[model samples]
Target: MIRAEIVKLYKTVHTWIGVSCGLALFIAFYAGALTMFQEPIARWASPPAVGVEAVSLEDAPRLLELVAAAYPEAREEGITLHLRGHENEPARVTWVEDEPHEAGQPHGHVHWWATLKPDGSLMAKQEEPSDLAEFINDVHMRIGIPNPWGSYFMGVVSLLYGVTLIAGVIVLLPSLAKDFLELRIGKNLKRMWLDAHNVVGITALPFHLVIAVTATAWGFGVPLWSAQESVIFGGKQKIAMAHDLERWRAPPPTGEAGAMMPPSQLLQRLNAQVPDFEPKVMVFRNFGDKAAAAKFAGAERGYVGDTRFGGVILSAVTGTLIKDNRASRQDLDRRVGTVILALHTGEYGGITIIWAYFFLGFSGAWLFYSGNLLWIETRRKKARKEGEVEQSRSTRLLGSATVGICLGCVAGLSLTIVAAKWLHGRVADLDAWHAYIYYAVFLGSITWAFAWGAARSAVHLTWLCAAFTVAIPLTTLLAWAFPMLGMWAHGSAATVGVDIVAFIGALCFAWVATATAWRVKNGPADSVWSIRKAEGRTAARQSVAIAAE
Candidate 1:
């Protein structure tokens, strides 16, 4: 058993770490949970005009040739053929181009799509796909901080998060057994919050640890890899790194043009070699060249690896297997790395694990939120014992900031998602509008929270969050209800599932808003959480002035 003094030391460490990193972690967890359904969200936000029938596998070669002939630059940069052409990924062929950089700005890129018209003619359009899903993923990865610097900042936060986890576990070691299942929701608000936070944190400890390690690795992976090359590999760094990256390299195209085989034939050959292989994306390199190559990337069920180095590369011309990296055929090193990635992504366990991770992510968010609440409540109680009228200015300021940031994140994401349908064809640059809408709402929420007190802002913002979230499902339902309105159901199970889940989310937000408004009206007058306290103080001061007169 650990000694009492050691437990006290750990408690301090845990408290400080949790409080300091709580808000950022909250953003990460909340955004990360939504990312678990990244593909579904993408489909829901995409405009219907972008949807098109996927080119048949046998006809894919013709489409490829047409695209290459029409856009010569694609011959060099390559093209990606989507095997699963759902509404979200409606186009059969896609490619990217680097956006030209300005004198003072960094470089960027855009996506281009090629589709077959009903008349069997090739049509290509340049568009920036709805990046709402990727935006959320970015928020999760770096808490919405801009890249380079944001990644490094999150890396440090991730390392400290790991330490915080260890300290929390140690502090709870003594009463863990007795209170493992305890959730005392009663008059003592602090105890209730402590119990709730402990329950979620302890139960999801393993998940939290995995998240911390993986987040740290991703955030700092570049620097760590560079250091490893310079320090450990020494003079052989280039050779060592090249050897590792060799598995991913594709052969360059020969200058001579060559006829390409149909993709169906190539896919058939891949399946013959690896029966369990299911290809989702087929990438062609150096189209219409003698040395052209294609890689069919997909996943095998019941395996730890998803798609990375888990499929076969083939000769696009001869339909011969060039390299096999099938899940069952991987070397030990590749297998280990694939397993780590699979576990971190929860990609192995199918839909069940996806749902499990979804809840775990939200619970992780709740854990951080509850930690903040506990801090505020603890300070309030202390000030009361000291016979003070209010808590410290810092505490009040933190309360307002937390309310603003947290609610802003929630409402911003919801409102931006709603804009996907409302602004699709009406705007010239829909993708840019998504970003503008999100930032405006997010910044506006912060301003409101600071202008109004925490108690009032919390109630109003919670309702705003509910309304916007509800709009998501309502938009789809309205489309279904009125077919002439140019809105219609996507008809895919994925899109339907997204709508259903969003409706449920709306209800949850509404419930929280109701509860928060009640707390503002009826909760303890000594706390900043109760708006009644401020009103009562004002009324008392007015009466005292009248009596003195």
Candidate 2:
């Protein structure tokens, strides 16, 4: 087939894909970029909920007693233990139970937690729902809808993003060699836009492709498997849900009361026995009972592999060994899960990976924006050449769709963050405030998308997003300027981490706005909302020359 033939097929598929999933893709990528910083942002938004006092292994028993007394159901059901006293991550005890609610549903299961008080009592405050983080996550996951549907929608979007990525690279393969230092501008704006889009799309191919495939797999993995398994073979939903829940398991406690060694003693033993690892959490199940076993799990920080370390359960009283999660070295699944979380959450390599993901996220945003630009450029040239006073319906609609969808994400995020800050003391329902902000911004952005031209909307909303995004961290920092806000500060690494990240994010967005403004300042004859118009002519000529090649 001729090159034009390939281009034609690609153009048709690409336009359809973009037109169909462009808004969804824009929300996913834009929100995902923010989701990368979910933890830090959550920490930043909520005041420290746990204390960092180091609890001696000896005192864990007393603390456990208080926790049992405080939340008996949680104690009887299951509780998580944290032993790392590092500043970034304070130690805490958490118990989960169907926290009784008026709705008679177990939706808000109380994740009761408490930090180790210096006096040995649990010292934890109820963790507030983090609005901004949750909102961003909802956008990434399912646009905040209920399960299966949200997951299903996200799954489809992820698949579309994957297809578009693959098809894009295929279309760019022929022009891969010639364009190096090229971001063309000037006459035949459509071709220039096409070339620019191709360059960014091709250059960021690896990043987008990796995220697309992984995300789609994550989104639809279980759903597709379940559908196929149920349709083709004898399978059940109960089995699948059970399998999912099995990763979270705890041994049933024995009611028999027997003399058990203190948790402090057990910790001493764990340190002596597992000399190479550092304990993170110790769980004493069936405490003071015949079936009691104390498991010591830690982070093996100095190792090449996963940071997670397993535990050896003892008879609490007899100090007899029970089991080791890492004894067979087959605990790779748990570790794999951790690494995947680290990848998605920017936790593994610490701040370096975190910053890398941040910029890559913005670059991801730009990748989509340039695609919208190419759409406009391609259509505009035809309209101009035909001496048609106006663009066709499809072009107008595409432009509106692009502006509404992409800019809506930015606007929604801005409004959400602002609501987070403003509703701190006012609203009883913070999550509701966040939802309202998102819904309102999103709806308003769509209206703007249709009302304002895509170019105008992109420029205007981007500037607005820049301002709002900057305001969030800055307002927190400015609130810091008062010094009283320091009272809200804690030794928790998560809290400090959140504040620092917000400031850094603000600076980065400032850079984005400044650069975009400069580009707009220096461009061609016929562009309305951009400054890079000068590169259009050279870009168009080169594109034709290559096509003729």
lDDT of 2 at 515: 59
CA lDDT, every model vs. true structure: 0.84, 0.64
Q: List candidate 2 stretches off by more than 4 Å.
A: 1-4, 54-58, 84-91, 101-106, 115-132, 180-196, 231-233, 236-248, 258-288, 292-328, 331-350, 483-549
For 268-311, candidate 1 gives per-residue lDDT tens digits of 87778778778888888888999888888888868886666677
lDDT of 2 by residue, 114-196 (tens): 65655655675444445578778887778666777788787788788778877776676666677754777766556676776
Total clashing residue pairs per candidate? 0, 17
In model 2, the Cα lDDT at residue 79 comes to: 48
| Model 2 root mean square deviation, Cα atoms | 6.9
Where does candidate 1 have its weakest 10-residue lDDT segment? Answer: 47-56
